[model samples]
Target: MSPSIEKNNNNNSSIARESITEQVTINEKLNLCFPLESLTQVRSDLINYSKINDKKLDQGLLSQLMIDDNLLCRYMKRRRGHIEPSVQFIIGALEWRHSLGLDKCSEETFPVELFSSGGLFILGHDNTGNTVLHIRVSHFYKIPELIGLVKQFVMFHMYKADEMGSRSFPLTGGWVLVFDCSNASLAQGDPEMLAFINSSLKNYFPAGQKYILIINLNWVLRAIKTLAFTWYPSAVKNRIKFISIKQVTDYIPLNELPDYLGGSVNCYRSIPKNCTTLETLRSNGSITLAQSAYDKIIKILTLVN
Candidate 1:
């Protein structure tokens, strides 16, 4: 289907559940509608081929990252003395995504986070049984300053590798990068970051490029806030998309996600439906999966135009 039709249909499909749409949940909706049969098959196949000790894909990747990436090895080793708690988890997640393509218990990145419902949900209960963390570390500092922090954090060890040993590290070549903003937003869209990001969106993100943007999600709020009423809106329309990482639990049927983008018509209908999604789905879990798929598939039954 054409992008416009897909967007329109996707937007109109979720009329019943717009009352509380969060980022990851919106992501789930998009994924659910995209191609589940294929995605599930790929997911299962990946797990079967991988999964050491029955560990999740992300976990396995972390292990591989330590052994295979030299720059990363030095980075980790350097931090041996530092031993920061936040870095431990962040490094673990980044390593996993860098090496293996897997989602988390709550929802991790392809290469970023874990699987699940609301990250900050009450006890964080995802249908898939993953606990997600909804954190937004902000540094209302300059973009260059933040970027420098990231580079220093990652490349610091990269530079130290020479003193540590060139042959003993796996990170001689840094890991590839892939950046997706589908689940991102900024507080105040900073023009500097926005411009750079949009430019990358246009000419940089080649078919298989892997990018790493090490920033707290909350930074997105700040980054986005700056761009909300900026001059780039028209120039960068649809070039990039961001989803908030907060709405994981508010899930219903994928078929019901599109209506969310309907602006007002669907918005009006969404209020009441969202209020009752829990009860509705709770009573009908038996059929929601199939029904959601069918509703979306039926839309393209003819595949005309």
Candidate 2:
């Protein structure tokens, strides 16, 4: 109860308060870097939810989930409340794929020859610097294969988005999908294909598809659009444009597209044999760079916890 003892107790109380204040300040900074609703925690909750539903998570899948979270967080940081619903929808699609025991489609397993020969290729960037994914819908017969090819292209766009640091807003500096349905037939409209396309546009493409220009839209495409619109959210539906073959130049310059699509460029070539494998894509420098950043963010989260 002496003056010295009382002073010592007061000093200890002051130090404790300072420590708590410092901790709160650190957390506020972290929340700026990483929102309070951490994507890592969301991923964990998803994994646990999957397990309860009799789905097992393997290391490879877990690694992918991490990458996905990283990609989502990168964009979500900028958009935050505006895009969280879309981000969550994407996570749900991933979870559904995992639950169905569907392995992530690899570049090797993808029908590269079919895509190359059939006229689906990256036709360089559009006028606005968005990567153009040129697809010849006529060449596709098998719906699942088409879905797989599209999925690979989606990943390709994500890779480019990461490289460009297109994190400020969803679909900013992303992909412009040009679907040339010149020879597309009504017979190609399988329910499963429609479902997959709907899912991709709604759940996956929202983050990367800056503009979806369906050119050479015949009756078949018009019919498909009717069906797809029923499932597409309003934001996604707004990005889609049913255009004439000649109208594509409004979005993509003639020099950027392939020769067949009114451009002088010869863009169709075999997928590099070495780069055809999923391993190669996974080891891409851009992806590695993004993953490094992701790892650091995760480390911070770990320390905070």
Worst 10 residues of 1 by lDDT: 107-116
Worst 10 residues of 2 by lDDT: 296-305
lDDT of 2 by residue, 131-202 (tens): 667767665454331344445554543444433434433323366667788877775445565575556445
TM-score of 1: 0.21
Candidate 1 lDDT over residue span 40-116, tens digit each: 34334434445442443345444543333333333333333232422353344444433322222111111011011
TM-score of each: 0.21, 0.60
Clashes in each model (backbone N, CA, C under 3 Å)? 57, 0
Candidate with top lDDT is 2
Per-model lDDT = 0.31, 0.57
Q: What is the lDDT of residue 199 in candidate 2?
A: 65
